[model samples]
Target: MELTDTINQVVNLTKDEKLSIEKYFTVKTLPKGGLWIKEGQYCNHIAFIKKGICRIFYNDQDGNEISCFFMPENNFISSYTSFLTLTPTKENIEAVEDLEMLVINREDLEKLSKEVPKVQIWRRVIAENLFILLERRISMLQSKTAQERYENLIKENGDILLKVPLQYTASFLGVTPQHLSRLRKNSVK
Candidate 1:
């Protein structure tokens, strides 16, 4: 799908509003495993995935990489807290597959929001969606069992198995790889 179409699907923009958004977006590509943003660095841009998948992760206290989230095609990916606050990111973003992205810089987004009132509305919609997703994630982590979480993931994002590595998916689900394997085996039976 075209970038404009993707943006409109996310924000419900009018033709003129889409044209304005297009002015801020720049197309870019990254190879698999490429780091789009790193921990401790400022995130100056937000990426809208056009193709392929990206993972947001960070090194844990034990120096193990823990996957936080995945962004598939047509999804928005960013270190949102860092981007909003202009502070160092605690998360790292990397391409899981060769990726095509439409990126917009923070400065450009701010300028657009000021110039187009609709852009502010779009920003709020995006923020609200992110907030809801985060809340759901927190609840899942706090109350769901490993098997329940795995089942919920399969139900909500069946396509993720095809897009993300098993180990990464296990990490994102907050379980050991062995536990995930056992859970999957049990589900199949």
Candidate 2:
């Protein structure tokens, strides 16, 4: 998947603007279980997944990992709070499977937006989508029962069974693994 193809999916850009934006992208591959960014390190680049899966997770005071979100093929991955504020990340981004991605440094992204106006539109669209997802996630946690959340997850991301481990899925849904197992079994019946 080319940079132009990904950008086009998110926002419309002129041919020239697309060409300039592409120049800033560097393609990289990560092995399964690779740690891309560790806690307390600044995330200097934003990654666009072309293949495989990655996840953003944080550790709780009890030293247990809490799964925040998963980034699958054709999705964008970043520690947004740290990236925007240029602060140390509180979360870790790890590759769940061998991954291919196109990355752009924060500085280069800023330069590209100034050089090519359309890139700004692309950035705004991406930010808006991120905000919407965050809002929906919060709502799901606050308003939905564990069973409802699990059902909604199955409805929205049916392929999750193929892509993610059950334990990780349980963590993402804010439930114990046994609870998720029961939910899954009940839903299947």
Candidate 3:
């Protein structure tokens, strides 16, 4: 379903509340390899994916891009800390394929949150959920082996292996591409 149709699952929006959404959101498209948000720039908006996938990543000291996560259809993507605080982002979010998004800027979001009570409650819910997800991700990375991480990723979203590039998936697992290849082979047997 399009984000517009499914938003109620995240936060129930009434007819009036849905109308206010139009005031805050704009539809944008990014081509493959295009950056929606770049490192060192202030993240102004949170985007809801209407189509395709985006990779969120950061560069390591060695200049290797480390994948943080992949946002696919119906998901939201943002450099959350930067978006919330209006600070420069240390991460980049780029399209893995041609992407369509419905985006809401921080200023408009804040205004809508103030004017629309449901939106304000939804924003708080989003924050709490994001925080929990972040904490879980950190804990998983710190405690799990590369193979374990790869298996967990498969458990969560098996299609990611077929849809996303192996290199990016490897980075997200904190393993080299070769290791991922070996893991895939082992998992098949």
Candidate 4:
């Protein structure tokens, strides 16, 4: 599984360490439209997406929900800024589809880190990955045209258009729904 493989690839966990760490994780599920974490709630658990999509969004000053990020299957997700600081998250995490995930609570993660120091390294790797993703998204928004952003999204995960709502995709691309429709239509032509 991706969870095991990613950890092993990052930290080179020993067989015993891998087996022992399994106790710290639990399988959890969320139906479509279910919220995993709400805005202003502490995100105590980090989840590895086994099968589904989760959208991370927050309301802007205009009180409009803005799609900030999406986590597809095989990736790890958490309100990283909130999880690491033990503060309320600004974004709400919701399942875009029925989700099956492996979740590890922060307290249990600390305990596992103590037992296996390699876990610390893995945590750092995960955090760095989150930063890289955020940075790339910011870069796209700051420099790329809407068309370029859409092209990048399509190149990266075209299936998202089929699975996720167009409105959300438009928000993610930093465009209005109508503009996204034009982009989509043009792509087909």
Candidate 5:
């Protein structure tokens, strides 16, 4: 969905407000396997995925890149902590597939909020939704078994395995790739 449409879905925007908001976003793309935000980079922009998928991951002490979240088309992707605090990101966001997005940098977003005060409501709603999602992720990781997590992933995103690699999906589920293969085989039976 378009940015204006997404904003309207969250909070009703006047015609002028919609036009004003659109100008803040610019089109961007990243090829598959490209890093959108590398670790230690400041993520100053929040982008809406127009197409494709990306995974947000971080390197463990052992230097394993473990994916924690996936962003699919029509959704927003950002390192919320870095974007808000103006600090370096602890994670990398990589395009799992060729990506197309509309991004608004922090400065323009601030200007947009000032220009269209109601944009604040939209921003708050987006942040709240992101918070809820992160909370669910933490709860799942803390309480769920690997098999249960795999099932939940399947239930939530049926085509995700097709889109993301097995290794990444396995890491996200707190399982080995071999174990994930077994889970998939069992799920099919």
Candidate 6:
């Protein structure tokens, strides 16, 4: 995706502000299994996916990995709470496929927001959208049956089942791998 076009979708910027933004973003490549944000490390940057998929997850006491969400192409990925508070995050974001992303460090984003007034509004809008998405995920896990949740996932992202591994997708659906198998079987019937 074009960097300027993506940024413009978030906020309208003047010529100088556009140049200021262009200077701050860097393109980065991550191989499969690369950790964009490691558990217990500060997330210094937010990444916008240009290609491929990633999972945000945390390891439990028993070392079982639980996926919190998936970021596919054109989505943003970050340990947002850690990024905002400048603290280490328990969450780890790992590339599930070889990926290319546009990344901007928190400090650079902050500087841009300060220099460009519209950018600040853009940041707030991003945060609000993130919160809504998270809240809906929480609600689905709480209120929806596993079958419903799986169906909802398919409804929301039709190609996700093909793109993401079933194990990770099951975790996101709050179900065991075996349970996901049953769900998929039932769907076919």
> For this target, which candidate reaches the highest lDDT against the unseen true structure?
5
- Taken over the whole model, the C-alpha lDDT of each candidate is 0.88, 0.88, 0.87, 0.90, 0.92, 0.88
Model 5, range 1-189, lDDT digits (tens) per residue?
Answer: 777888899888999989998898999999999998999999999999999999999999999989899989988889999999999999999999999999999999999999999989988998899899989999999999888899999999978778999999999988889999999898888
Candidate 2 deviation (Cα RMSD):
1.3
Q: What range of 10 consecutive residues in model 1 has the weakest lDDT sum?
A: 2-11
Measured against the true structure, the TM-scores of the candidates, in listed sequence, are 0.94, 0.95, 0.95, 0.95, 0.97, 0.94
What's model 3's lDDT at 59?
100
Which pairs, if any, clash in model 6? none
| Candidate 5: residue pairs that collide | none
lDDT of 2 by residue, 119-149 (tens): 7878888889999999999999999999999
Candidate 4 matches the true fold with a TM-score of 0.95
Q: Kindly give the stretch of ten consecutive residues in candidate 6 with the minimal lDDT sum.
A: 1-10
Clashing pairs in 1: none
How many residue-pair clashes does candidate 2 contain? 0
**Cα shift from native, residue 136, model 6 (Å):** 0.3
Best by TM-score: 5
- Tens-digit per-residue lDDT, 1-189, candidate 6: 666666688887677888887788899999998988889998889888999998999999999999998888887788999999989999999999999998999888888778777878777887999999989999999999999998888888868678888899998888999999999999878
Q: Summing lDDT over every window of 10 consecutive residues in candidate 3, give the lowest-scoring window.
A: 1-10
Candidate 2 minimal-lDDT segment of 10 residues:
1-10
Score residue 144 of candidate 1 by CA lDDT.
Answer: 95
Q: For residues 44-133, write the lDDT of model 3, one tens digit per residue.
A: 898889999999999999999999888888887889999888799999999999999999988888898877877776677778878888
User: How does candidate 5 fare on TM-score?
Assistant: 0.97
Model 3: lDDT to the true structure: 0.87
- Following a full C-alpha superposition, what root-mean-square deviation does model 4 have from the true structure? 1.2
Local error of candidate 2 at residue 136 (angstroms): 0.7
